[model samples]
Target chain A: MTMTDTNRQWRLKRFVQPDEILGEEHYELSESPMPTIDDEQILVKTLLLGTSPAQRMYVTEERTFHIAVEIGEVMSGRGVGVVMESKHPDFEAGEIIQATLGWQDYVALTPDDKSDTGKNVRTVQKVPNPVRPLTTIMGLFGQLAFSAYVGIIEVGQVKEGDVVLVSSAAGGVGSVACQLARIQGASKVVGIAGGQEKCDWLVEQGLCDSAIDYKKPGQDLAAAIGEHCPDGADVYLDNVGGAMLDAALQNIAVGARVVICGMISTEYMNPRPDGPKHYFNLLYKRSRMEGFFVFDYVPRWPEFEEQLREWYSQGKLKLVDDVFDGLPSAPRALGSLFTGGHTGGCVIRVADDPENIPAI
Target chain B: MTMTDTNRQWRLKRFVQPDEILGEEHYELSESPMPTIDDEQILVKTLLLGTSPAQRMYVTEERTFHIAVEIGEVMSGRGVGVVMESKHPDFEAGEIIQATLGWQDYVALTPDDKSDTGKNVRTVQKVPNPVRPLTTIMGLFGQLAFSAYVGIIEVGQVKEGDVVLVSSAAGGVGSVACQLARIQGASKVVGIAGGQEKCDWLVEQGLCDSAIDYKKPGQDLAAAIGEHCPDGADVYLDNVGGAMLDAALQNIAVGARVVICGMISTEYMNPRPDGPKHYFNLLYKRSRMEGFFVFDYVPRWPEFEEQLREWYSQGKLKLVDDVFDGLPSAPRALGSLFTGGHTGGCVIRVADDPENIPAI
Candidate 1:
């Protein structure tokens, strides 16, 4: 073959553990030129990226759903980028695009986000990031925000004076759920966090009415939820589904609602988790438990974004991001979620502005 | 205190397992010299009596709940008796009474049932048995029929062409649930039985569209449900919530509903059962699992009953009773549930007919 350079890419040479870096030299960068666009394709430049614990698990070859990345495959992630070139009528050159974009510096365009194509294809929606910080929308407000909103408001169906329990209370989805339950009129939000700091943060943010530190070894979460919420939890926003789901199951109030969001506890295991153990409490308490994927709420996003923005303007929906500052550090920050590295949303800083892409 | 003569009463002196009959010898028969009635009470004459597995499990001390006989308590059960004397306005002499009349030939005044001295203390619905069988109305049709009807029609919300899985398929609740599911628009019904005989009977009675012998070692029920149900089950009437529940969980189609009617498999354990290991399947499958106590649907009994009686009259509802003659074999029949010793509803033949007695 002729010596022609190629498209910019973050090639996944091998998987790494939590203690290991993705390596500065791990990614190979080259570009012959930008590709000519089609009527349906839009070329977008990488902007800010959202790192997830799932990505870390995916990278380590621990997760089952993922096919182990071959010797050279692009690192997977969801990110916000700016359209550099667009032939698609819906997208413009300068317009922003948010997608499950991989760790590459540049990615080709495709509207089929859910497909297995190498490009980070997704149902790209224009998230107006001018009113608030774009970083929040990219990090806290988008993925985690919608996760909490859909899980709590819709799935959990929280009501006024109702008690709510959120596992991984200081993490992305749980924190957002805690805040949303309060906004929606939850009487008491008891958070289950990893440490005193996180628990303290939860209570201080007014997101939680009380907090139980899981890091303290054994904080009888059921007892705490029972004590602080004498009425018992009407809505349980479960992010950590294994033991926390079991604990919440025991203390479920009559007609309680359990929102199954994610199970981070079992996500890192070689085998999936065993029984949550206390789910029979659902039968005894006459409660209902349901699961939801945030992507299922995309059509409702405009409505959610409107209400969420209103809450933000009213200081009801506060955003938090435990952002790491570099592409090389992305894997480490994302790994923190499973390894207890961060206390909030794990987001990676790819670029400060949409106009900062260097010429090839 | 003056002691009365030996009164005819069903007493549980000790707990016994299945096949071990707690015969009349195990009970101390007493003959009362016509006791006087008191305020808010009515004396009743001996009449028809039957038994249920719940009472059997309780009488045998093989259950988690405090279903103990208290060393000499009348074996708790439901029966239809005649009122000879009445001091309570709601109940009068010569009026028949139906409460959780403990396993006794004749009960004294005070229509107390549970711990409640007054609540749920009245006759559910006074009845004059005519043709189809009084005990059938009082036993199978009373709670058993209602259990199946309420679960499939009320909770499972069975729809036309919906596939339903009934665990403990040959037992009381399971057998009834299968029949009710078929009646309530279910096009396909699968019954998980303990043996080939039970499976054959289930299919013969048209209780299930398909049957699986759970007693067969190494039978993959999940695979069977998947194979038998190509579209997946829309409703699951689960009476045996154990490993079978795990299989059901895996085979549940998206939006499928699980009606947790009973958990016979795990009921006897001192410690609570560790349910299906893959319960989070509820989340993955976007399913809803709900448990309904038959007591909760009592108010709707008139509506439910009118329809049920209509079904029974139309020969739409199947009455499966494993009748054990006399109170001697009652405990043995009751204990048959755990061992899968009997098929359908089991009733104890206490009397040929009931007579109305006058109030004190």
Candidate 2:
């Protein structure tokens, strides 16, 4: 492949208002010279971009764990790329890697300054050779699957015979969570998803034993959960918060474990929305509710990778993605997460896989 | 004491509305023939009544974990008493015991039916010869202190140098939790109480390094928390859950432990009030918020008693109570919890301790 001078990026044009939906106007396609690599840097050619509600957070004016996306800067995001040129001793050309590469065609990961220590030190990690498709590496066997593993096994502690309930069940993290719960010997896996199609799709994949279509008119979600999980749920992996979480709270069994994975439902609501009114159920049922970030468990990724890779190879797990073609499709793909317009791992395919890329 | 036909009891005359304050109209002091003990029953003379906001719950029509108080029935409550008569093998006369004796001078404990298993089997426990005063046994060394022990030591897991923040800091559960957190090696303990007196009392006892009078005019609770817990709270033991919880939520450290011990603030609200609006902070800070009932930790009582008693002996822990005189004082004492009128353990001193009474 020949090196190109033109590098196109989806630059943040404005901060997203709390109540506003993301649009093309929020970000603009800007052309610039390709980023240069120093002796300690690696230039990466972006392939697939992962669209998550977390990406929307980067565009906000509020201070997050990392710096917010400023106007005229490439919108912060995560993507898997191939190393096109490298000066870093730890990286080489043609290697597949993953990092917070932003909404850009190329990412040059520079070395950390002397003051950078531990998590402050930024570096791209080489993607392991896949047992499944390379696209599955980013969706199921990679960051998406890694998040589910931490929530289900490490945080939720899903044990044998546990009845697992997942909100946003057909989405990126929830899909993997449902399968991971089943593989870990959950007696029943119940899923709550929007629309009849996603509900049917979840059960069709055998990811859930029962699925509740939350988008159905006049749906009493709490009653539906009771109908499916008569004994009440033992573990609830919550992604969509707001009213859905309140319904889940009512159906949790005594000593239930409610894992707070995400709150996409209320993320964009303006004047700080009301929280789960039934959170007192946490006391009444003697249950526990906890929130965690996947990065904290990064040091233990190899342990999760070993088990996940084995499960993928044994045909015990299914990996799927909702693909949006081309780089310009990023904005709509991300918005689909909040509106429940897409299922599985939402991926913006920036480019096709390189020829004869051998599986690990 | 001579047995008399005059069995004075406080019976629920009517259900107290959520917004209305408790009054004499809600309960009536009725006279009835003393309860007759059957062959498998024990008759007890009530002494001290432990009043709590939870007592207000019993009078409500809604069914909780336990049964609700019925009209014309003695109001459900917990108290210490002397066993006047016993026909059951497990009990005997003249022994001081504690049980859900209700707001009555005399109580007859009936044997459980064969089908009655688990928590349905009700029985009284003999009081140990406490190293502290007998009143203190029911307040600090009994259910109240046990709940605090489980929350602070077990759930919150207060470690050395941990900054502990407690809400309702002078109430039954909160008072003990504040002291217990300090005893567990917490470096800085900040308390949130309703008034200046309670705030001063919390700091005067040396239970907290700082105290925030939440009721003070123009006081910004979140800012006060920031001022006191400069490093952010490592463990937050929440009793009054509402806006105070929201304030504490905002100031939690990266890996803070939030122990939901009670939600007295919303227990009386008819429509069930909104919860902590800042609960999303759980996700941002990667913290764990868990609620627990003390009964679940009954198996670990001795573990708590050992530490509590040792601290009492060493004068490292101070146990205090707000005393109300006579039987008619029960309703008012319970109401005081909601109004934040009384601090420490709200105890209704029904009668004096009898001499030569052997403790079990």
Indicate which candidate wins on DockQ: 2
Model 1 CAPRI rating? medium
Model 1, runs deviating above 4 Å: A1-8, A14-36, A54-71, A112-121, A139-141, A218-226, A355-360, B1-7, B14-35, B56-69, B85-97, B109-124, B128-131, B354-360
| lDDT by residue for model 2 (B70-142), tens | 8888888778888889999877788888777888888888644423225431446677674435677767777
* Residue range B141-244, candidate 1, lDDT tens digits: 57777788788888889988899988877776777788888877888999888889889998998888889887777778788778877787899888878788
Q: State the lDDT of candidate 2 residue by residue for A1-360, as single tens digits.
A: 556688889998899988888878798998899999888888998888887777788788774645477789888777888889899888888888877788888888863442422443144667757443566776776677888998899889999999999999999999999999999999999999988999999999899998999889987999999999999999999898888888999899989988888898888787888888888888888888888887677777778888888898899887777888888998888888888888898988886676445221
Model 2: residues >4 Å from true position, as ranges? Answer: A111-121, A357-360, B1-5, B110-121, B356-360
- Candidates' RMSD to native: 5.4, 2.8
Q: Fnat per model, in the order given?
A: 0.58, 0.71
